[model samples]
Target: MASITLNKLVKRYGNGKTVNQVIHSVSAQIDDGEFVVVVGPSGCGKSTLLRMVAGLEEITGGEISIGNRVVNTLEPSERDIAMVFQNYALYPHMNVFDNMAYGLKIAKVPLVEIQARVDKAAKILELGEYMQRKPRELSGGQRQRVAMGRAIVRQPQAFLFDEPLSNLDAKLRAHTRLEIQKLHRELGITSLFVTHDQVEAMTLAQRMMVMNAGVMEQFGTPEEVYSRPATTFVASFIGSPPMNLLKNAPDARPGTIVGIRPEHLDITATGWALRVDALEMLGFERLVYGRWLHGAGNELVIVRSDETQPVPGLDTIIHVTPRADRLHTFDAATGKRL
Candidate 1:
C-alpha cells in the first residue's frame, strides 16, 4: 500500500580496518503494489539488502522509509511488514490456521477479525481445506503457501519474500509462481522478492533490481534488462545459458567485449564458423555448444536449435550468425556497457 525507499543504504561488519562491507550505498524506490524481485548470484548481497529493508539487518549508513516514515531505528516487529522466509518457518505442532493466526494473536487483534483475515488469506491461497493440517502433513508447495498466507493475514504495508519458492520441485514451482501472481493481483500488496534465479526474476517481477557484489547492477523491466543489459555481469547472468561474452573479438574496438544470447544466433551460410563441440537436447530445442573457430573459440557459445533442426555430429564445423540488433557491447576493462 506504500512505496519503500532505500536511500544510500550500507551494511558492514567488524570495526575499523578489519571491517567487511557487504552492502554498499544501495538506493532504490519500490512503487506501491509493485512486485519487484531483487536478483543476483550467491554472495552478491541480494538477501542482505532485503534483510536491511525488512529491518532484520541493521543499516550501517543511510535511511529506509516505508510509507513516508523513516524506519532506520525501528525493530523488525514494528516495521509493519510481513516476511515470508525461504524455510517457510511454519510451526510443526500448529495447524495451518494457527500458523496464520499466531501473529494476529500476538498483536491482540480481535479473534473474529483474526478468523476473518486467516480465512480470507486461506481462500485466496486456495488453502481452505488444509486449514487443520499441520506442517508435517503438507507438501513443500503447501507449506510455502502457508507461509504466504501467514504474511497475507497480517495485511501489512508490504511483503518481503526471501526465495519463497526455492524448495519446490520444478512443476510445483511453476504452479506456485502462478498462484503468487494471482495472489498479488487479488491483494495488490507491495512486494520485494529476493532470488538468485533469473527465471523467477523474469517471470515474477514487474521491475527487477539486479545486484552484484553489493552494488546494484541494473534496475528496470525484465525486457529492458534482457534486451539491454547494463554491464557484462547483467549480460552474462540474466539469461538461461547466459549470454556469450566474446572476449578479444577480432573486429571489436580495443577493450570492447561483445555479448550475444544463444537464441539470437542462427546457422547461416555467412558469418562466423563455430567449431561444433557438444549438443544438449531440451525436448523442444537443442543447445549447440562450441567455440568460434576463427577467433580461437576461447569461450563456448550456445545456440538453441528447434527439434525440427538436424543435430550435427561433434567435431563438425557449424557456421553461426548473430542477429545484428541483438549484439550487446561492453567495456572489457570495467565490464560496463559501452
Candidate 2:
C-alpha cells in the first residue's frame, strides 16, 4: 500500500486566453491503506481527478506524489497504480486465468510467480470456479470480478476505481458493494474511487470529497458531510429525496434559506399546521408532502413516518415541525452554510 498526495493540482485544456480549467486548485492527502472516494454530479471532474493521479491525464500545474515520489512525468506503467474501469475492460477471447495473468506476463514476471498471483486473486474474488470460462460465458457480475482480479494480480501501490459498479443492475450493485468492502478490508490497500452516486460514496469511503463544477465543495467523513454540510448544494445533494429548502421563509433572516431533511421532521403535537397534498407509502416507511399554512410561494415540505397513523390527505391540516439540531441554515445570497 502507498500514500497518495495531490499538491495544488490544476488541469487546463488550452493555453493563454483560451485556457479552460477542468480541475481547480485541488489538494488532498490520502493515507496508506485508506479508502477515499471522490463524489459529485456528472461533469464535475471527479473522474478527471482520478485519471490525473493515474498518469492518464496531464497536470497543467502542481504535482502528484505516490509513496513519497513525484510522478507527474512518469508513464502510467511507471506510476505503480492499477485502475478498474467502469466498463470492465476484459478480453472476450481470453479465459479467466489468462485475463488475470496478462498484466504480469507483459511485465515479464516469471511464469510460476504469475500463476501464483493469478490463483490468489481468483480465490479472493471467488472466481476460482470460473477460471476456465471466457468473458462471454460468465455473468456480468463475474466479468466485473475478473476485471478486479486483473488489477489485484498487479498488487499496485494504489487502486483507482472509476465507477466500477455502474454497469451492474441494482441488486448486483448492492451485492458487489459488500464484496468490495470486504476486499478492501482484506487487502488493506490505498484506494481512490470516483463515482456520482452519493450512496456508494457514503458506504465505501473513509473520507469523501464532494465536488461541484470543477470546484470542491466539501471534504470530510460521510457523517460530517451529511449531517453538517458546508453548503446548501451539499445539504440537498447528499440525501435521498433531497432536503426541503424553505426559500423565502417569513421567519428566516433576509437572504437565508432554511434546510430540513425529510427524516428529521416530525408530526408535532403543537406546531404550524401543514396541509397534506400527497402521500407516498413505501414498504417500511411513508412520506407525506404538505404545504405550510402560514407560508406562501407554494413552498413544500416532506415528513417521514413508519407508523400507519391516519394522516389528512389532499389539503388536510396536521401539525408538523422540524428537529432543532437537524435544521440547516444557509445564506441564500451565496448558498454557503451559516
Q: Clashing residue pairs in candidate 2, if any?
A: none
How much does each candidate deviate from the true structure in C-alpha RMSD?
Answer: 1.6, 1.6
TM-score, predicted candidate 2 vs. hidden true structure: 0.95
| Global local distance difference test of model 2 | 0.90
Model 1 poorest ten-residue lDDT run: 246-255
Candidate 1 off by > 4 Å: 295-297
- Give the number of the best model, judged by lDDT: 1
Can you tell me which runs of candidate 2 are displaced by over 4 Å? 16-18
The whole-model C-alpha lDDT of candidate 1 against the native structure comes to: 0.91
TM-score of each: 0.95, 0.95
Error in Å for residue 290 of model 2: 1.7
